[model samples]
Target: MAEICCQEAKSPPATVATASASAAAAAAAVASSVMDRRRRRLEMKRFRLATDLEESAAEYARAGKRQRLQRTASGSPPCPGAAAPAEAETVDPDRCPRYGVSSVCGRRREMEDAVSVRPDFLTGSSSSRSHFFGVFDGHGCSHVATTCQDLMHEAVAEEHEKAAAAAGSGDEEIPWKEVMERSFARLDERAASWATSRSSEEPACRCEQKMPSRCDHVGSTAVVAVVSPTHLVVGNAGDSRAVLSRAGAPVALSVDHKPDRPDELERIQAAGGRVIYWDGARVLGVLAMSRAIGDGYLKPFVTAEPEVTVTERSDADECLILASDGLWDVVTNEMACDVVRACFRSNGPPEPASGEGTSSSGKAVSRAESDKACSDAAMLLAKLALARRSADNVSVVVVDLRRGL
Candidate 1:
């Protein structure tokens, strides 16, 4: 530095000026490089922030969709302005009374239970509508249950339509047993078709992926109830059940198809199948239920023929319940009825209208309260089952049948 200064002093003023200018230019270049680096870092940070926000939004949307699906699957009423589930038929709320549904995985590894509710599914010539509610418990897969949820009601509706056409009028006293039998037969055929067809898109479950050839072993228990103004028709192909609360008394609408039952055992033996006691009198040491929708390998033994029951409705009827074995295993029919009754009582009644006739607004208020009570009852039952240590999926559907407040 001293040598340069001495040389500059002896050389010329122009030399000193030139050196200073070069030094200033170098400092400017360094400063510009630093600014460029800072600018690049800021842009990268902004990009990351935008990506994170988009991801968060997408996750939120997915969560909301899942919640909606769960609500629909559990038979809970949809929120105002929300779209109805694709599997359920559109319902006219005025014609359809309030109903509630609750379903949970409980302690199961995978959820295999499904519920379907289609209010006003079948309309008669006189504008009378029959509501449909069903419960399906799948074994070895969830596809079967989901399939039943999607197709069972439609199949039943088609059969009803056919019967109505043949009888020349939907208002005529149609044979419900024949109609239900035909519908179940058709549903079984469709289930078989669905299992065999590999051309269709894959399911979201691990059953098919784990064992492609195990489709024949998959099956589901179906308990369906068609509720009209005058009657209640219940059909059962397996252990799921339907019960009615009439004037606060419990009524078993459908019997469970257990393998150990005398009639079921006789039928299985007649079909050349044995009910071995592996995990509770399973047919051929495999399926616990004597009858089911699928199980092609055990078709002759595990029939799809549902036992149908028709009951005349009465003004004293309070509510109707349909549930999978998970609820029935731990809770008795009477207890279930009691729970629902208590819920109804807890909610009390809507205020009476001033006039003798019920105003439209008064009816709406009553319906809303009834719906809430039903929801509470169904949820409580499911929770009760869980608290009792149920090891399977729990599903419950509560249909409010009260005529007036």
Candidate 2:
């Protein structure tokens, strides 16, 4: 019994267990550090790639080789030869930072059209910033379209500032809806003056000879959109349109203000423009519905007041499409939405965690992929419009709220 007790007195040392625990913790720390480093490197690489792509796009645009106007159909009237108004040519790309792709092949006439704006706002609250995107389709002349492109956003911003100041609102905050409305009004007014000034400066200009001899008579259709974090506000004057895709379906947001609708025909006739039916057709062969801006000479025949619509997007709203008549002439709102959705599904952006907030999470999921998808989609639309033999200049602006980055 004494010998058995002495043998059992010997026990294993405790050092081996302590050493094993310490080694496991050290390995874990090393693995975590390695993962963190990898994540940081990936993020940096993504940022650099996006920046380089954006810069390259800008340089391509500035080089002037990328802007080739689309041609008109074989028998279409030649595009008006007037130069884009002075202010129009000076559009500052820095103020608007958008990413897009455009192509124009003027079949019978020079394409005098413009599409898209930079997502960056020139001036606004840093916390509640907004993005501007638009498509201006010029028919009789490019001056009106170009002028609107150069100055429309600025006009909106100015009116917004004045309204906010008058109402004593806080810094950089303005009612975007009101601002958009007033800006459209202001744009018509400013365009009228600009056209008049150009006409006066060059009495012999060909654009004057083509229409009712007033600057307003030589007009282009406008479809503009201002996108905010919580809302999307669209304004349309003329036949241009703004459409949206919600949950893989198309929903038209802007009414096409044409000369044929009963109300529009009555208004056009009342304003002094002939809303006559050519042969058996109504509204002088014009298929558009409602009223529009510009067409100054037609002002008495057509009203400058635009139909405004403000929509609060649901969680399902996926994309917005703004286009000139060229696109609408060929593709319906539903078709446009379908194309965008297909592109999104096929070449969609990446999903990467950015921060802890829900908004950031959404942004990370939507905009993390390559911007080439957006550009490719827009180009595809324009190409399709052309293929459908859309006679007018084609311009399209596609805004992917989910993947705009």
The candidate that wins on TM-score is 1
Model 1 C-alpha lDDT per residue in residues 1-405, reported as the tens digit of each score: 999999878788888899999999999999999999999998887667556543543453465455445434644555676433232122232366668999999999999999999988875453578889999999988878888999899988888887888877543367788888888888788778867784255654576776665466788999999888778889999999999999879999999999999999999999899999996889999999998998888989999999999998787888999999999999999988987877766555322322122221222234566577789889888877876667889999999876643
Q: Ten-residue segment with the worst summed lDDT in candidate 1?
A: 354-363
Runs of candidate 2 exceeding 4 Å displacement: 1-99, 106-108, 167-177, 203-216, 279-290, 350-369, 403-405
Instruction: Output the number of the lDDT-best candidate.
Output: 1
Looking at candidate 2, what is the lDDT of residue 175?
66
**Global lDDT scores for all candidate models:** 0.80, 0.63
Writing each residue's lDDT as its tens digit, candidate 2 over 1-405 gives 988876665433456677888999999999999999999998887667556544543443343222221211234443376322121122121222223556474343787787658565547444455677877776566777777888888887677667766767542345665777777777778778877776645454457667434665556677788776666778787788888888777888887776666677777677566665664333435424344456665555555566667787566877788887777887888777766655555543323223111121122223323355567667777766765667777777777655322
TM-score of each: 0.72, 0.65
TM-score of 1: 0.72
